[model samples]
Target: MQTTNNTVLITGGSTGIGLAIAEVLIKAGNEVIICGRRESKLLEAKQKFPQLHTRVCDVAQKSAREELYQWATSEFPHINMLFNNAGIQKEIDFLTGASGLYDEESEIETNLVATIHLSALFIPHFLQQQKECAVANVTSGLAFIPLKIVPVYCATKAGLHSFSISLRSQLAKTNVRVFEIAPPIVKTELHREAQARKQSQRGIAAPAVAEATIRALKNNHYETIIGEANVLKGASRIAPKFFHNLLNKVATG
Candidate 1:
C-alpha cells in the first residue's frame, strides 16, 4: 500500500511504538490521528507533533472503542487505515498467586479484545473507502515465545497473532489489507517500567521498529516480524522447548 496521503488512526498513539509510527507517518505526509486514555499524554504527543490529531478514548472498553470509531469516521471520512497498537505489559508471578484479578482483565481487554473489536468496527468503513485501505495489528515477539513472567501479556499477543491470520483469510477478497507487525522487545516506557533497568535498556529502539514497519508496509509484507523478533519466531518453530527454557532462564535471572 502507498504510505503517504492516507488518513490513518492509531490506538495508544501517545507513546512507544504507536507514537513512533505516528511520527514517521506524519513525516511521510499521512494524516495521522492518535487515540489513548490519557488526556495529558495525548496533549504531550500533540505538542511534539502539532500535525498529529489526538483523541482520548480507551480502546479497552467496548463503548469507548465504538465512540472512537464513530468520531474518527465522522471527523475524517477519508480515514482508510487502522493501526491496532494499544497494549499493556505487566509481569505476573502466577506461581506466587499474588496477581490481582484486574491484571488479567487489563491485559486481555487492551491487548486482545480491543484489537479484535476495533478491527471489526473499522473493517466495513475501510471497505467503503474509494482508495485502498489497510488494518495493521501490532503484536509482539512474545506471541511466538511466551515470557513466563508476563504470561497474560504473551497469551494476549499470541491470540492476536492467531486472529490476524484468520482475519487476513476472511478479508482476502476484500479491499482491506490486514497486516500483523510483531515487534521484539523495544526500549519504551511500557517495557522499561515493567522490567529491571538493565533488561529494559537492552531493547531495540521504538523508532527502528517503526522504520521497519514502514518498509514492510511498502513491500506489502502481510506478516512483518521485525529485528530479533524474527529470531524468536524462527526459534519457536525450530526448538520450542529449548527456547522456552532459555527465555525463562534469562527472564528469571
Candidate 2:
C-alpha cells in the first residue's frame, strides 16, 4: 500500500477504533470517507476532523451497502483502500437467552453478513483500480479465543478470519491486497463498562491499534496482530486448550 494520496472508506467511523483509524489515515494525507448509521455521530466526527468525508449509511442494509459501493466508485474514483471496521458486541447467555425484546440477530447481521456482502460488492471494483488497492478485515483476538459470554460475536469473528484467508488466496493473482487485523481488547466503548467493572483488567488503547495499523500497512503485513492480541493468536496456534480455559475463566468471573 502507498499509505498516502489515496482514498479510503471506513465503516463505523464515528467513534472508538474506527474513529482512531480515520484520524490516523486523515493525518497521513489520504482522502478518507467514514460512514455510520447515525447522522449525528457522523456530524460529530466531522466536527472534530473537518476534512473527513462523512456518509450516513448502515452497512447491514442491503440497499444501503449497494448505494455505498455506487457512491464511492462514482464520487471517489481514486479510492483504493477499505477498512471493514463496523461491529457490535452483545452479552448473551443461551441458557436464559430467548427474551421478548433482546435478540442476537443484529449481531450476526451487522457484524458478519454485512461484511461478506460489502466485500463481494467491492472486490471487482478494487481489482480494476490502477493503483495499490487493499481490503482490510478487522477481526479480534477473541476470534481465536471465544469469550463465552458473547458467543455469537466471537463465532462471527472466527468465521470471518477463515473467510479472509480463503478470500486472500482467491485474489492472489489480482492487484488487490487482502488483510486481516486481529486486535486484542481495545479501550473502546464496545466494552468500556464491562472492563471498568474489573479494574485489574484493561484493554489496549485505540491509538495504539491505529498506529500499529499504519505500520502494518507500511510493511505490507497482511495478518496484523498487536500487543496481547499476538499472545492470543499465538496461544490459539500453540496451546488451544490453555487458551480456551483462560477465556472460560474470564467469562465466568
Candidate 3:
C-alpha cells in the first residue's frame, strides 16, 4: 500500500505506539487523524503536532466506536486507512482471583471487540476508494505466547491475531490490504505512568515499531512482527512447552 497522500485514522493515537505511528506517517506526507478517550491528551498531541486531526472517543463502547467511524468518514471522506491500535493491558491473578470482572471485560472490549468492529466498519468505505486502502491491527508478542499474569490481555490479542487472518482472507480480492503489527513490549502509557516509564527502558522503543510498520506497509508485508516479537513467534512454534515454562517462570519471579 502507498504510505503517502492517504488520510489515516488511528485509535489510541494520543500516545505511545499509535502516536509514534502518526508521527512517522505524517512525516511521510499522510494526513493523520487520532482519537482517544482523553481529550487532554488529544489536545496535547495536537499541540505538539498541529497537523493532526483529533477526536475524543472511548472505543470500549459500541456507540463511541460507531460515532467515531461516522465522524471520520463524513469529515474526511478521503480516509483510506484505519489503524485499530487502541488497547489496554492488566495483570490478573486468576489463581487468587485478584482482578475484577469489569477489568477483564474492558480488555476484551477494547482490544478484541474494537479491532473487529472498526475493521468491519471501515472495510466498505475503504473498498469505495478508487485508490489503495489498508487496515492495520496492532496486536502484541503475547498473542503468540501467553503470559500467566496478563491472561485476559494475552487472550484478547490472540483473538485479534485470528481475526486479522480471517479479515485479510476476506479482503484479498478487494482494494483493502489487511496488515497486523505484533510488537514486542514497548514503553507506552498502557500501564500506570511510572510503570510504563520503567518498562520503556527495558522494552523496544515505540518508534522502532512505528518505523518497521511504515516499512512493512511500503513493502506490502501483511504481517509485520517488530523487534524481539519474532523470538516469541519462533519459540512458540518450535518449543511451545519450553516457551510457556520460561514465560511463567519469569512472570512469577
Best by TM-score: 1
User: Candidates' TM-scores?
Assistant: 0.96, 0.94, 0.95
Tens digits of lDDT, candidate 2, 1-253:
7798979999988988899999999899999999999899999999999999999988878899999999988999888888899988877778875641145337776788888998998888888888888888889998887877778889989988998899989989888888888888887877754675662266888888999998888888989987877888888988888888987786567
Residue 201 in model 2: lDDT: 64
The global C-alpha lDDT for each of the candidates, from Candidate 1 onward, is: 0.90, 0.85, 0.89
Clashes of 3: 0
**Higher-TM-score candidate of 1 and 2:** 1
Which sections of candidate 3 miss by over 4 Å?
A: 96-98, 103-105, 191-200
The weakest ten consecutive residues by lDDT in model 1 span 192-201
Ranking by lDDT: 1, 3, 2
The C-alpha stretches of model 1 lying farther than 4 A from their native spots are 96-98, 103-105
Ranking by TM-score: 1, 3, 2
> Which residue pairs in candidate 3 have backbone atoms (N, alpha carbon, C) closer than 3 angstroms, thus clashing?
none
In candidate 3, what are the lDDT values of residues 63-154, reduced to their tens digit? 99999999999999999999999999877767766556485348889999999899889889988899999999999888999887678999
